[model samples]
Target: MFWATGWKPIVLAAAMLLASASSALAEEGVPTPGDLLAERLDERLGEQEVALQAFYAARDGRPAWQETATVAALANALRTLDADGLTPQDYRPDTLVAAHRQALAEQSSPAARARFDVQTSQTLLTALRHLQRGKVDPYRIDPGWEVPIEAPPLDLAAISQAVDARRFEQAFASARPSSASYERLRASLARYRHIARQGGWPMMPPRSQSLRPGELHDDVLLLRERLAILGELEVMAAGVSAGVEPQATEPRRYDERLVAAVERFQQRHLLEVDGIVGPRTRAALNVPVVTRIDQIRVNLERARWLLHGLPDSFVLVDIAGYRIRYFRPDGDVWRSRIVVGRPYRRTPSLRSSISHLTINPTWTVPPTILREDVLPRVRRNLGYLWQQDLMVLSPSGRRLDPRDVDWWRPGNVILRQRAGPRNALGRVVLRFPNDHLVYLHDTPAQALFAREQRAFSSGCIRVQGVLELAQHLFDDTGTEAEVSTLVAAGRTRNVHLERPVPVILHYWTVHPDEEGRLVFRPDVYQRDAALLEALDASPTR
Candidate 1:
């Protein structure tokens, strides 16, 4: 009886248990945790060779995250992945923890524990990938979007070291994005989820037409409630409901205040700023709160892709919003209106460095543009080339007469436009070394910037204040006076940058406005639905 406190019985008991475990493992053909983990890796994911090799190569054949304390830590971490808009079921941390407990109780086999340990390592890897690069492959969602090759796996051996007691949570968190914009969106996502849990905003009843500002109908009451829940309508007091109109005076009246609120909502949605709710405004307002919640979630996924390792100075182009923002380390240096690709020809998400700037740039139409756009126009009017200040060049770069060529037939003749004020590529062009052959340049059509939705380009982006952008890029090389002189000279000039600035062209339908109110834009190319569907199918990783 007193042997409970003695060391001899304990040592013998441990020896017997080890002998039994060894016999059982040999019977199962898995002698150690490493052998079981390897067997599970081969059985479950034969194609995940890279992850498997990376996972085991670091641990010297031991389970890095499969130990009891480590797995419990991972379980706690996995439970909170929803805070970052991730699905907890994707990791199945509860099942892993439960199985580990079963193994400790001798109810589960060593194989089960080995399987849990292997998958937990895989879960860490997959979750890290998600935190760094987004859930779905951006290129698969939209072929125009550029996605880099898979980055090397993290140093899991170091992360799982006993000396570093941060566990999976703190260790894996090192891969998360650390940007202010991402943080702000994360905060907004939490608030929106809270709103969702509270039953979200009410759905507006369908009417044949929209409710005007001055009309006094029951639909107007619903609209008031809708705007109040959307945070557009300002309440009179903390306790008072913003949706409630003043009682005993005018229960059914569209006062100027309501009209103003409607206008604000329209502005938030990039709709026509008319106080009256028309069909377009009505359609926007009728979008369900759940749909907006999904929109926020979709954009949050995109935010993860661009969150980390950004340059000190860079440019961000919001494709759907038709805006460009230049940033330094501190804040936005400048912002300009931009025209992105049309519905058919969308501007793709790109991440590239601006290597050089081109002044008095010439426009050479791409083959696709020539085949689709120029050919049709030329077939109609033979004088299109002369009118548009364009010329035809043969294969050898010699000028050719359009009269001698057949406009109906397809050929590889290049269309070159001269460098001038009316040139398609206005004064300066910021060139990125890419295979896509798309560059940011100026445009003469300044009036288009005044419109809310500006998806008017073929594919290349057209900048409003392109001169300022050029001058900004030419920071140490030259001055505004020098660039102005160069532009006036009318000769083609290519100026190299001392240090290239990074440029990212991305798309997002929802973002917070200046006042931190969520604003939405039209899915110009109808991309949101496709992306949402892709996200629905993106859980395999």
Candidate 2:
């Protein structure tokens, strides 16, 4: 094989040094370097011993990390792991470099060289595995996560080939997620870390009253400085004048410009865009830059969890963001606000494909909702069933009188709402098969979508402009009209799509907007704390 010219001489020099080391070891009555390397591989590598052994066996049990250029490249790769929201100390690049230098100095000791070689290989493999999948498993952190974590199996052969070819950087890059969203978040992480290094924005003092436009308050000055540091405000220099006299208290006044900047900040944080700075807005602005950095890191870990091998087209439900985006092949995207499950009835993260759409769909209350929601209402007044247009049915699909059934111990019965304006599920329903029985559908309560934090559903997602989304998903010109006709006819009809579009119901507290700016959302499910705890924990391996 032809090695790259840049490192060919270094490889030859390392081979010669290895030969000299082996000859010296033989003179001292010690085993050959390859034999010692095989022994060290067995002792150091617990679960990965077989793979490392097989990798070395292909090269006649020779040490692969003898070349200084290869080890340096591995060290560089480990150092840059921080850019991916990974801790560089976890890989211990400095220790690896120091060990390599010491091994080179003691060229006569095959044992030292063998140990360094094994350590280098093990560290490289671990780093690659973490980059490809993640440091922590999703199932371990989130027991309710249902999305299948798909990652390419670790190929030691390919890694060895890359190291031999001296393409370590390219290999590490290929291991990470390739989606634009992941890359954007990675860039934001770097910027936020830089802000931390520069002593992040100052905290604003608490105030009981909201800061409205054209009002004067001392806290507004601190708010302006905070927003200015975040690039949301354009602050003129202290002495720079634009023909207007600068008053001492002018900055403290809640001017229109500062209000606009606050609105922008509120928009990015997924808070209400009102021009007034209320408690919620103040709380968001007062969040420490270090916390925001950690938020970016946590979401970066989340991006690694689900961004691999995405289809050409798919529907992504940003649960925490309270929004849905349907991505198409031609780069066109359709988006709408959505109401996800409440915090206690948290929406699960899963991947499924939308195969069909139901026009004028009926609503069936799930078991949990029935026990926790409907039973209480019905037990108080049997008239509640009639008010909600819910019909009680036996397990055999036989209709039962609501008055005769015992609401307290209603066993083996179903509560279904007929199709109408009062139905919980509105005019159209997008159906996908999953164990959770949660699907995206139109809701009668459209007012909920207007709220910034839309987490009102039992477990299913209530989508705004769902009919339009159904039109996009249909992907068939004729089926769109058919769906409209069925809905207008007020008849229950299921229309299968010509091509099933993949759907991913995901939870992300931070994601990049269209302009590539990071948008932070409330962790409504309170998932980030647990995930961050797991991520910061020591590696299980």
Runs with alpha carbons beyond 4 Å of true place in candidate 1: 1-73, 107-112, 147-172, 206-213, 236-251, 329-332, 476-481, 538-541
Q: lDDT at 133 for candidate 1?
A: 74
* Deviating ranges (above 4 Å) for candidate 2: 1-62, 101-112, 152-167, 236-249, 476-481
lDDT of 2: 0.82
- What's the alpha carbon RMSD for model 2? 5.4
Model 1 per-residue lDDT tens digits across residues 234-278: 743121344775544254466667789889998888887888877
Ten-residue stretch with the least lDDT total in model 1: 234-243
Residue-by-residue lDDT tens digits, candidate 2, 412-514: 8999999999989899989899888999999889988888888899889999999888877765323445557678899887888877889999999999988
The C-alpha local distance difference test score for the whole of candidate 1 amounts to 0.75
Q: Best candidate, lDDT-wise?
A: 2
